[model samples]
Target: MSATKASKLYILDTNVLLHDPKCLYEFKEQDVTIPMTVLEELDDIKDRKKNVAQEARYAIRSIDSILSKATNSEQITKGVRIILPGKDRDIKLGCLSIFPDHELTVRTGFLPIEHNKDNKIINCALHLQSTFPHRQVVLVTKDINMRLKALGAGLKKVEDYRTDQLVSDVELLPEGHHYLDTPFWEGVDKVESYQRDGKAYHRVARTLLPNTFLNEYIYDSTQDFAARTVAIDQESVTLLDLGYQHLMNQSAWGIHPINIQQAFAMQSLLDPDLDFTIFLGSAGSGKTLIALACALEMVIEQGRYNKIIVTRSTPPVAEDIGFLPGTEEEKMTPWMSAISDNLEAMHEQDERPQSSVKYALEKANIQFKSLNFIRGRSIQNAVVLIDESQNLTPQQLKTIITRCGKGTKMVCLGNLAQIDSNYLTPLTSGLTYIAERFKDFEGSASVHFQGVFRSRLAEFAEENL
Candidate 1:
């Protein structure tokens, strides 16, 4: 209840709730008030059969349930207390009568819905803020334009709901020009200590580095051993286990070039101790394979997690098992093949316990869940892999990440360049969204697989065509 203690009343925006339904709990004993317009938007999105819609539906249901328990008032259910402040308020400005619907909606320069709904929502916020002059009234929205308008309207405060990355300290470095020396190549091998003229080396390669601040050389290798420059991109290199061992003693898991990506991913995944880490790459980039291998090592080899949990976004994104018709396993046959194929390829065994991942699910006690049913449940001590994550929106991504319980590590993998969503672009897509946000965090690392390594034909088509 920090916001309450500070006398700050946050008006929950619809997109914020849709982005993360459980954000209500995030305040943790804080004063959060849901706008009546958010509820109306939720009602419309609740039964659309899409993940975002389903999330909207689930959030409202949860909030209603909590309120019902707390107050015994059916009107306000869940943790959210819906209020329509606009019921008594009249439009002070006559702009709507003079302008078209689009103009009215665009006048304030923010609209999540059609012109009419947008105006009503803004009006509702304006009315509520006017009533609570003593209290610090703030509008919390996921829509950028909405937040801008709220600030411009002379509200107490306005902020975006950034649930993904909360960057505390920002750091930046000069481009291409880097400084490197001995001990920088301590752990990595085949690192010939050679410097290109006017080009900097940071040993490790990355697409983007953390932001710079306070006029500091963020890439000081002497001070921080792990501080790396961003000039180099990791090449598709072959790797063998670092230790000297008999040929048969080495595990097949780390032998493949694909395994290198997974090994790096696993290293990052285990850190931060958070529930989720998203990995994005092209086909043959070892996203699914490494995730499965790492999950197996964690569950079976390392004894860190209790079970392996794998799921995919159903089409239009994942296959629809409903039309195929059979047992639960039979229904999930097509979608489960990705996991099975990765397992088969990893083990290099034609003969296994079960041909289908569904059967493997039964034998391994691994949960092959669909994203649709993961609303309220919190998965614990499990290695959860969500494939085809590129198809998800920023909102859908947040819902899944919030479902991770203590001791659970969730991995999301999909190719951003290979997107099929008509409504999203690369910058707005989930994969890039996560990468851009979390790249500088201590427990996170993002590597984009550039070259196609699956097959020569695939590589040729990727590069030439």
Candidate 2:
């Protein structure tokens, strides 16, 4: 067998390409095959009025860019040599081919051609597996059910597309804070206390907390002390002393934190120095409430920002905002009802709750925006709140984040456990991506709220269900 056939063959799936368009070039030195059914699905999706349409177009473009290099249909079927972009262009990788699965004849052990798209793709893999019995033929997809079905259908190799997964386990992700078993001071061997610009700071040895990152909160079991890492070096870490009482006392739009996690989230939100913040938690953990309250305070009360730009990833089933009636904001209102709910919760005690929410909406200059229209526009002097961020991919998050111009504070809130995207998991989520990527940046902070304070039923559901 030729060296190209000796290497493993990876059959690409439609969902994998939609999840990450650059996936065509991700497999190093391994041949890739795209079945005709996958291309048909991409073609059908490319013109749709959803976010995935853009991804579909991108995947098509990427495939065309490489396959266009081939001079003949025979080369296209056999395989076209894969080339890496930029400095690595000289290094030869694997080959990419388009399999004519539509012309494939059904054989024994092959799934019925009348089966769904997934089964057809699996049939393509099974053909390749039989054609090259000595080589490994893997089906790469983001769908768990598809993987199971592929295996059950007798495909030996099936895997999820995990090239972007940062952590194997969700629990290994950073929580933005560390809880000390004993008093923080007791564990410290040496410390230098001083005042800088009227703020107290403690310079402690880096060995005290070797795993510390910028803006990470540290608190002890006593709940008497709380400090945020302001600076870190090889020798020591500078901590800004924030009294635990002060963090709890911090209020935004008349909302007070009921737990230390909430307090940490509020502190991160209210800090003027932080330009980016992330809140990761379960549903009913007050992520949206705290973020909305703080955005209102900053935009309406403090005048730190001119407006609040609220946007989120609509569920895959409801991504076609263009199909909805009225203007963009009107179309986005349904997906952003969580913001409205939080606004009402903030003003629930007022004599006119709906009137208060309406007033706050107008006064704070809050604008509901669809994620589709966010790209390529510079958002300035605004507090951008991205809800349901866990559903977004890293590329989508980067597109929105890069739109932040001067004097913009970006807040992302999401529950990893509540991700609705079939292509994403907690580890591969954009929220998790940014949380890990920005943990060491001084201007960013992350807080994971552990409590579900919406109601007793919600708390019970969060724990048990």
Candidate 3:
């Protein structure tokens, strides 16, 4: 039997637009409808200084730009055509319509006509469903509760706006290293080792997995050995020679590696060739402690850079908190408390009797800067540390990274699961974005911290609470 297929109609929620202004054009050939209520919500937040407001303004502007070319509002009601420009000009932009909430005629009487925004938006989609009985209507939103209500009201096909998701599953996201099965050494029967500039190298013709990329680390549990691929060409890989004992024996600024992951982080932080490094972990994983320790060793001990420059997105208060009276550094002290916390922890943990927190800060020549005026300034000859960086958007991260000058080593530390910005998700955060994008870049390394060295209570809270 042959039956005509129903067309798909997707109605967007306010959060989708606020999360990603470009969500309007991601629907491909499916028809898109934006209720007037969602636009009303956008207008309310369009004037603020935070990222949400900025995205709302952009969405509003994009809609206006397309609608300006339309003949009239009635044209939009009937379905207005929009053109998406790109190298592949054949992108099928489905029709976009502004549906009025009051015109909804779904269920006839199941839901009452109300001034509430969610009800209005849902009712609009319900109306579209009733009007086109042969069509499938879906409500798209990043808000969980909204999706629940839509389903409760008999709507189907409610889904998360996945245009910005970087990975299909959280656990599958790169941990920057892999553990090899037993007999790893025996498989490498043709292994060759050599010395270069007092360092080591290895060439192996082992049967490796297809996903092995440049700078990929392979850890062997039986022999307790680890190696990284320096070069890869299809069937063979050249490994930068290294062993577990050497890494575990090292300490940076009196801070020894508490786990294998921290050891890798310290190595990456101390490597001058790796001008860029990223650390990802949850709370109490010692990510920041290891990074700050290595920065101190490099700047104050090794004389690699002039100073330690720290900055992060001023989140948890992107909008106005209140007026503060102080110089720039003084004003930034409250936000830099985490930096001071780790710095003081380092000083307390230093093995030397004469070690002092104040003296260490002075010796390191550390500077706490803000992201507000980071634009147009070239930061050179410094060890740049960006903490709590998950709050940054990808575009914002690009803006900050592009400002790195010659001889500057940039380091980022953050937990993707703890992102606070409403405009971001773990899969779309600046930290994950950069990690996935820069995994193959030369002299760039990323490490995922594994253990929680803090109090047992803290560990319990992280796992249970």
Off by over 4 Å in 1: 1-45, 55-255, 258-262, 269-275, 317-330, 350-363
Give a tens-digit lDDT track for model 2, residues 1-465: 134643699999999998889988889898999998999999999998877788899999999988899999888888888787668456667898999887773544377767588888998998889889878999999888989989998999999888877778888878999999999988887889999887899999999989999999999988789999999999999999999999989988899998999999989888888999999999998999999998999988999999999999999898898888999999998998898888877888899999999999999899999888998899999999999999998878988999999999999999889898877888888888888889889999999888888899999988998
- Please give me the total number of clashing residue pairs in predicted model 2: 0
Q: Model-by-model lDDT, in order?
A: 0.55, 0.89, 0.78
- Best candidate (score: TM-score): 2
Give per-model TM-scores.
0.53, 0.96, 0.85
Under the 3 Å rule for N, CA and C atoms, how many clashes does model 3 have? 0
Query: On residues 186-205, what C-alpha lDDT tens digit does candidate 3 reach at each position?
Result: 66667778899888888776
Model 3 vs. true fold: TM: 0.85
What root-mean-square deviation over C-alphas does model 2 reach? Answer: 1.7
Q: In candidate 3, which residue pairs clash? A: none
lDDT of 1 by residue, 412-440 (tens): 88886676654344545666666555554
What global local distance difference test value does model 3 have? Answer: 0.78
Ranking by TM-score: 2, 3, 1
